[model samples]
Target: MGAFGRNHARVYQQLQQAGSVRLVGVVDPDTARADAIAREFGCKSFGSVEQMLTTHSEVQAASVAVPTVLHREVARALMEAGVDVLIEKPVAATLGEADELLRVALEHKRVAQVGHLERFNPAVRATLPLINRPMFFEVHRLSVFSPRALDVDVVLDLMIHDLDVVLTFVKSEVKEIRAVGLPILSGKVDIANVRIEFESGCVANFTASRVSTERVRKLRFFQAGQYISVDYARQDVLVCSVGSAVGAAHSFATDANEWGTRPSVNPQIQMAKPPITAEEPLLAEIKAFLRSVRDRSRPAVSLEDGRKALELGLAILAEIGRHAGRIAVGKG
Candidate 1:
């Protein structure tokens, strides 16, 4: 467990109390770090996944929270042992690694999950029923400078969540990608802007920055005659509609605009706040993973889904580099 691993450990412990699964063991290469987190969560610690699995053969499922590079190795070992896994986001460091993880999971028939926590967000779940030909999206995920996750750029660390969500929503092939990024506080790209066009003619613009002064996480989209907004931090969703008056306004729709009292060209507007049952996204993800393991069913965020997100992330990184080279040549 490193920066985000403590949170994973905490959620697993919470899951232990709330359900049938138990937190059997936590493994870390650093014995001290593993012991500290284990003690905090009332679980045992081991030097590695092998040691843990050797001692605790009853372990059926695990959360692979290792670093980006170690994901393939850690997850491969677990799956090979016939254990289901919920590997954390970015799935793997590269597309090849991601594909291998998927292959192993399939060959082992293990329940594999990708840690796209936002997929379980109450706001996102609530907004799903409201989707209808989403034409455009504007997403922003900003955070104040943090030393954690500096190993990778903001594209993988922060923007990938939105990328996964948008890809799920659009369900279309990416046709074009234009991106720009620069390093600020870290050696990796600390801030980035991306514009993606999909085969469905949908367009999305994303902005992610780890060197921001304020924290903001929100996504807003426009569809045909409707606008929807999602607040990730607050777990809230707001849907505004045009050309379709709903609920109580349905009775008055035909009266006002049709009687010549108002312009017929303008349609009555309606706004609705979809009801949401808010829960910790991580907890929900763990619960879902455990359920998948027990039932041997596909996870909500499957390996293929994670791979697609990683592919897009890698593509965006390449596009950023290409743009940087163009800018440098122009400057020269």
Candidate 2:
């Protein structure tokens, strides 16, 4: 099992221990790792999806944590065989591949979900009711150098999380995009900065880097008079507002006694952190997937949502390419 695949297995085991679902089996080309995970989780391991399916014909749901290129092929096979799927992010390598996946899921009438794990973060969940009319956003996701997920650029590997969240919050069509990216340790883009304008007059700036020395995952946004911040790693949210802006839009209830009060420079400005119930995001995502599969209902993060994020990521990549071309031409 790879990085995320192992995580999926661990969460499934947790779910199993909680009496929510059964850990049917695991599949990996590397049978040793598969067997090790299976033993640790108290489940069976198979060398391939076909082998797993053949062994457990009653398998109803599965998670596709394979490479981006193999997503379509593996998911298509599973869906066609009457298995619901929760595929990892960047749905497919290309938009056409994403479309094919959409068709397959619809045609098979299978409940398909994309694994945009950050959507389940408690901070994101806590920020939902506070959103009034978000006008501006500043987001950053940086990670120390890693050799993982190098098949795609930083935009897809990392920034797409913010793209999906921002898109969900704005609920507006993207009007313009300006982006620049560069390669570092990997052959693909390792760092990128992007500016996006939505038709609703909202603007967002995103910076993602896989070559950073330290790790940071944070998003800050402003509405009319309120500013909100989310810390993905800490699963925390802080809301700051001035004068009548406090609780003007939403009835944000916070127990100041437990959270404590911190005085601001301006007496009129108030700051508070809304209550957050911290839970492992991966655990929540798997629980949601199991719920969808059990109820035979739509997924929280559908394949269409995944495709939209991928579309935006690809557009950013295209812009980066064009920007690089201009630099090359100038040098010539």
Candidate 3:
């Protein structure tokens, strides 16, 4: 386990303490790193997946936090051994690899889940009830420059999270994609801006960057008679609604100061804050994976979902290339 892998180990330890699941062991090619994390988390360490499974045949479930390129190999080994797995984000390095992963899971009948962490964010979970036929969206995910996650560009590394969420919320085919991206600090794209149009006549704008001066993660959407704002880092959702409250599904709390009495045509704009119980998203994701493994149920974010998001991400990268070609022609 590296940095993110260590975080996964930590969450699993916490989960075991809560009596949700058992922390079996951590595996990594680096024996030094694996042994160190195992000691720190009070779990066994193995230099390879084969050794781990050999020593602990009871590992019913595992989180494949290995590199994207190695996801297919590691997860296939786990599933081939009768173990379910939770593959980390960007499922694989390519669509073909993702398809192979799907095939392996199907053949083994394993409970496969994708680690789309944002799907388990408290704010996102809270915003589920506020969903309507969302017509428009504005999403921003920025981070101060860091060396982590540089294996893939900002699109696959960061924007894929929002892509997964939006694809789920929209539940429609992607109609068009327009994107522009360029690398700054890393050889891969470190900043990107994209617009995705859905078949349902919905549009979303996404900005993702890893070379920012500050950190921000927010998603806002507009639907009929409502505007929703979600702060992912803060784990908060704010719903501001206008128009008559007739036949509204969610009752609005009346407080003059909540939205501040507006003058003129805008009579009343009801604002509501949904209650959210905060928990580490990794813990939630792991617990959900274990539950699915135990009950023979589908995961919250299935492999199909991961494939769809990866397809969209690859599409975005393609569009970025097309746009860059046009710009280069002009400069030439």
Tell me, what's the RMSD of every candidate? 4.5, 6.2, 5.3
TM-score of each: 0.92, 0.93, 0.93
Which ten residues in a row are the worst by lDDT in model 1?
245-254
lDDT score of residue 68 within candidate 1: 80
Superposition TM-score, candidate 2 onto the true structure: 0.93
**Global lDDT of model 3:** 0.90
**Candidate 1 residue-wise lDDT, 55-107, digit = tens:** 99999988898888889999999999989999999899999999999889889
Q: Which stretches of candidate 1 lie over 4 Å from their true place?
A: 243-267
lDDT of model 2 at position 325: 98
The collision pairs in model 1 are none
lDDT per model vs. reference: 0.89, 0.92, 0.90
lDDT of 3 by residue, 1-332 (tens): 97789999999899889888889889998999999999999989999999999988989999999878788999999999999999999999899999999999999999999999999998999888778889899999999998887888899999999999999788899999999999899989999999999998899999999999999999999887788999999999999887574313223325536443443363367899999999878878888888899999999999999999999999999999999899999999
Off by over 4 Å in 2: 245-267
